[model samples]
Target: MKAGSWSRLAAACLWLATAGCSARRSEPISKAELLTDKPSERGRVVFMEHCNRCHPGGEAGLGPALNHKPLPNFVKRYMVRRGIGSMPAFPQQLINDSDLKDLMSYLTALKRHERGADQTALEEINSRR
Candidate 1:
């Protein structure tokens, strides 16, 4: 082929190759899908669906003891939406907003109960001492 024809062919091939490169990459998961309301029961459901496979309920399993850590609301929410360390990112579709909220609330409540139990034990110890 002539030089001009070669150049045109090369340009067309390059354009086709670039177009076929697959630009439809996965989108970043949104935080809004994660539930962030108070008393997050739905959030707990979300947790069970995505997290329970790895982490145990109110106990440590594939993951660490989530209840053991007395994390604040924002931290919990962030972790749930963004995931942490070994945890996988669960997008809004996987865990809707209400579910995230419920999950956080349930975890916090579990933590609270644990603290109360610890306090009661300490009181007993003090009384005996």
Candidate 2:
């Protein structure tokens, strides 16, 4: 290959690398971390503003109640980023990767906590035997 061609290829490679380096990878958020006030609150606000249009608190509206079993990480992220059915995609500007992770964690934590509460109640009743 000619020197000029090689130089052009190198420049292209460098540009691609620099661009990739600046792009942020989505990090997995911990359930405990999201349950906290900061990220959780941000997520909650984002949900209410964007999702509440379709999904009501408990009762179903345009969409099903999201209070069900905590969705798998992929599903949650997909729903937020890609949107399902009639849902609209939440852009990264509105909800970044961290925000999405935190929201998913918070929602899942809520579901798990409810399940634990129910189990405790069941155990108490069984102990009466």
Candidate 3:
């Protein structure tokens, strides 16, 4: 991954470490906050507002959820810029480069946190024996 991606990924890791500890993880995240919050929070919020209707939490909906697994930065950039099949392209006008970076970062961090959660759960289960 590129350095920018790594940094975003790091930020996301930090977010998970801190944010996951709260009860808010169970609370729903709103789309309006995505645009109004600090810069770092924009990506997921932008996605929820624009992309979530079609793809929720990276699961398959009308379209595919980005979080199903890890995807390359370039691939995502291309897909959004160029569009594929039934999906439509998102030009720079609609989503600036910076926002795209945030989106990728959000997706990567989301997956890592999920893996971490799964591991913690598994460890807890195994420890019971």
Candidate 4:
């Protein structure tokens, strides 16, 4: 085949491969409804589907604990969308406006729970002494 033909063929193949890959994961993630007006349940689905893989239970997994530091919301938001350190950036498409709102709720709730759990565990351990 001519050089031009080869390049065209390669481009076509690459496009097909990318399209196929995206199609496999294209099924929209059904977001869970917020149980209340509170932001607490807002980001649960997005968090579970994406963030949980790295930040299991919003605690340290492959990624560090999101709440342990309690940094500013903008900072966290920027870091998550833009990525920081080892954590990967989560584009708006994967986490739309609604998903991001709910995710903030999930993260906030997770932080409070983690704090409580930590205190409880410490108390229990001390009691054993």
Best by TM-score: 4
Worst 10 contiguous positions by lDDT, candidate 3: 22-31
lDDT of each: 0.56, 0.54, 0.58, 0.56
Clashes of each: 14, 0, 4, 3
- lDDT by residue (75-111, candidate 1, tens digit) is 6676666665567767788777777777777776555
Error of 3 at 89 (Å): 0.3
Instruction: Kindly report which residue pairs in candidate 4 clash with one another.
Output: 42-102, 43-102, 43-103
CA lDDT, candidate 3, residue 10: 51
- lDDT by residue for model 4 (1-129), tens: 975455446444543554311111111211222233355555766777888798765555696555555455655676678665566788988877667767776665554444345445566679999
Could you tell which candidate, 2 or 3, scores higher by lDDT?
3
Q: Which scores higher on TM-score, 3 or 4?
A: 4
Clashing pairs for predicted structure model 3, backbone only: 58-65, 58-66, 58-67, 59-65
| C-alpha lDDT of residue 43 in model 4 | 72
Give the per-residue lDDT of model 2 (tens digit) for 1-129. Answer: 975455446544543553312111112211122244666666667666777677643224776555543345675676577664566778899888887877775565444444444445556669997
Native-to-model Cα distance after best TM-score fit, residue 6 in candidate 2, in Å:
43
Ranking 1 against 4 by TM-score, winner:
4
| lDDT of candidate 2 at residue 103, scale 0 to 100 | 75
TM-scores, all candidates, are 0.54, 0.53, 0.58, 0.63
Cα lDDT of candidate 3 equals 0.58
Q: Residue 51 in candidate 1 has what lDDT? A: 78
Instruction: Using TM-score, rank the candidates from best to worst.
Output: 4, 3, 1, 2
* Candidate achieving the largest lDDT: 3
